[model samples]
Target: MDRRLPVSPATPLIDRFGRQITYLRLSVTDRCDLRCVYCMKARPEFLPKADLLTLEELTLVCDAFISRGVTKIRLTGGEPLVRKDVITVIETLGTRIGPAGLDELCLTTNATQLPKYADRIAAAGIRRVNISLDTLEPDVYRRLTRGGDVNVALTGIAAAKRAGLKVKINAVAMAGVNETHLPGLIAWAHGEGHDVSLIEVMPVGEIGADRSAQFLSLENVRAALARQWSLTDLPDNTGGPARYARIAETGGRLGFISPLTGNFCDTCNRVRVTCTGELYTCLGKSGRIDLRQPLREGGRDALDDALDAAMASKPLGHDFDVSPGAAASVDRDMARTGG
Candidate 1:
């Protein structure tokens, strides 16, 4: 029996499929320091500074969702920590959102700049963080991230942990690429006192990313971990959709987010707000309600009406099929989508 709350017409965010939207992914900036092959095109064109939502505008947009029962907000971007005044933004939103029963205020980052901001983030009321790193080996890391310093991310992770924030690691497990190193990645994260999540490479856009070539199944990853130690499921964490498990022998935890192979759309309860203020009901599909224009026009009623339209048209499930000839592609890449 499903234990989820029943979808209600009175609910401001319940979609047509009876799923109540409670989570929001807010992208602070589309600018990133590193260019990973899977997430960006070579020499990617980033969003200009003027295109981003001001802190005031973002707060107004968030208030609309909070009033409607949205409880979780995760700041994501090409790299959230890179944005100027991010700590100030987090401080503002975190202080305001929590009193209204918002469960979490978190940020996702590549962690290159986290060493500088981790302490400030903790002071700003962000108690949790998600770090994006694909490998532990410095050389492979540099190769995959296109000249990124693995040591810098490691230092940042240490900083995050020392700041008393809970850290979780996200790794994109691409076959024939990082597949063989999954165990090592998990072990490293566990050693660092963090639960590591292996994400299947999503088919978002074509930046020379061959989904069929890089896609790896979570079931296979689960089996491989089983060979090393006892693996058992743990309760799901808020802010992200990864299903976690306990590594019995080592006393570590592992998580798997297989969006392509394991569709969790039936219980999907999240929406995304892009850097440019486009509200996306589904990450893998394209149906956006522009909040930038109305938001800039500055009227409470206009914002409310836009939010209602988005809620009404919220998708039940994405039309993303990994099967050949039936697959769908998102109009924007992961950077633009707040992934």
Candidate 2:
């Protein structure tokens, strides 16, 4: 039985700055198999399972957003596949894709579980995925992810390709870490028919490391890549912050997401909801509304009110800084806030 609420026309969610909210990055869980150095601590405390919204609750919240004009929903997490019965959430949302409903439904994953769920994910209406892969070298990958096997992720990527799902490799460019190897990684991803996007490491949480040392600006990256390859800017956007370019040498598209060096908040059209149903209007700011209580206590009407409140409180921009010896912009880790 389809338990999702019917999508109906409603006034679109527009922030004070007039940016219409069309994209929702909803985190299904805070639990993950690998603890990346930049995302979380090696021995981070996991969120209590009881604190997370149930699959039914998640679906209802999504449907409410759909009714209010959210067209693109990206399921994120501390590895969303680690959540039990996540496919149920995916399948439910899959039915909502059409002219009258969602324009696209996608997820960001580490690709460790793609080998197990790729076919099922494709069948559930997900046409593409963004895989977080920072390094291709085995030892460096293991050290970065704290015991994760690169081979497993590679196998998962292959499985995703075989299942007919478009894959995009998302690498966090860190100074002195994977900076030297990124060219090879990009070429390999392009050779494998996958688009690649390099992201500047964000200071989201206290990972016990100096973020300034890790922060690799995309401006420097592009200049270096330009010297090696003929790069041409493209007017391509995937409803996110990435700026794309065509790598003429590989005949592939490359993207740069520079939240620090480049402020993308002017065109920001998305908000995030954590697994616990906390709605964050801006990722770099700590302001959030508790949608779980309203949804659980007062149902759809209350949920709608909370949504409106979120839009009204949406900040025009984020305040992310990665200066030397600087603290994290927000107290919450990327996993808790959604990756």
Candidate 3:
């Protein structure tokens, strides 16, 4: 292991491979309101409240990361909105970390719970909102999310836009499930003044165990869209390897996150932390630092050293591309992981 760590606290915390770690995806809670089949099992075993990180502890962790060059922080979860006091958690982190050089605070949600809190979340200092809506058709949406109401999600999206929050829709395109709805999904989001990105169904978690049939390549979907519309490549700086293109006719835009097809690992610049506190260096590969233990026993300096040591071993890429879509067979449930 390299004994040297980044000397400049203002610079990004660089790993052994020289990737600057600027983004931190923190999962505040593991409980969700809806059961997305592709994400987790229908009835997931929720973590005990005592085991999850508290708001103050999360703030401390964020402060530590910000000092080590984590500028962007995104709150994720099984469905973060389900957590009581979530708004306060968002506000606390945003308020405490902003002056310390935290550049952006964002969250990924199912939108099922957003209508009630979208305005407040925006006011809480969330710069952008990523809505996870796999399909636009109510029936298909219900089928995919197992009884989720698309109208409520649409209402939330409207509320988010009205609140002046930059909104993006993340759709996980599955074969025979949502592949046919790609064009419509993009059209609907675009019509609503939001850009939409289609992600290939990942083979992760127990839900991913038998998902070979569900995997749909974004490449194929892009090809189909190209047949109908003239697509223009657009520059994307969202800090992820997702490629963006403009739909020439509708003046809309679409992003494709081809993790399996292209393995964006070379450009990987983020890390994830489960609500229970395991810091995952890579979403698709193994090896994580026991952040909960360290955060509980070690305090700031100990946490810093632990993070530096673990990040040094961050993998170059994942093996998902080894089998394209089915190779990365992760047993950890997506709900439990800070996905």
lDDT of each: 0.81, 0.94, 0.81
Per-residue accuracy of model 1 over 1-339 as CA lDDT, tens digit each: 111122223346777777888888899888899989888887888888898898667766776676678888888998987888777778777775456547778889988887798888888778888899899888889988989999999999999999999998999988778878878888878887898888987778666655676678888878877998899888867546788899886678888898877888888889999989999998887889999888667565677678889878987777565454434378588887888
Which stretches of model 2 miss by more than 4 angstroms?
A: 6-9
The runs of at least 3 residues in candidate 1 whose Cα sits more than 4 Å from the true structure, single-residue gaps closed, are 1-11, 322-328
Clashing pairs in 2: none
**Candidates sorted on TM-score, descending:** 2, 3, 1
Report the C-alpha displacement of residue 285, candidate 2, in angstroms.
0.5
TM-score of 3: 0.93
lDDT of 3 by residue, 227-278 (tens): 9889999987787667999998878879999888757888789998888888
Better of 1 and 2 by lDDT: 2
Name model 3 segments beyond 4 Å from true. 1-11, 96-100, 321-328
- RMSD (Å) of each candidate, 1 decimal: 5.2, 1.0, 4.2
List TM-scores for all candidates, in order: 0.93, 0.98, 0.93
Query: Model 2, range 187-291, lDDT digits (tens) per residue?
Result: 999999999999999989888899999999999999999999999999998999999999999999999999989889999999999999999999899999999
Range of the 10 consecutive residues with the lowest summed lDDT in candidate 2: 1-10
Clash count for candidate 1 is 0
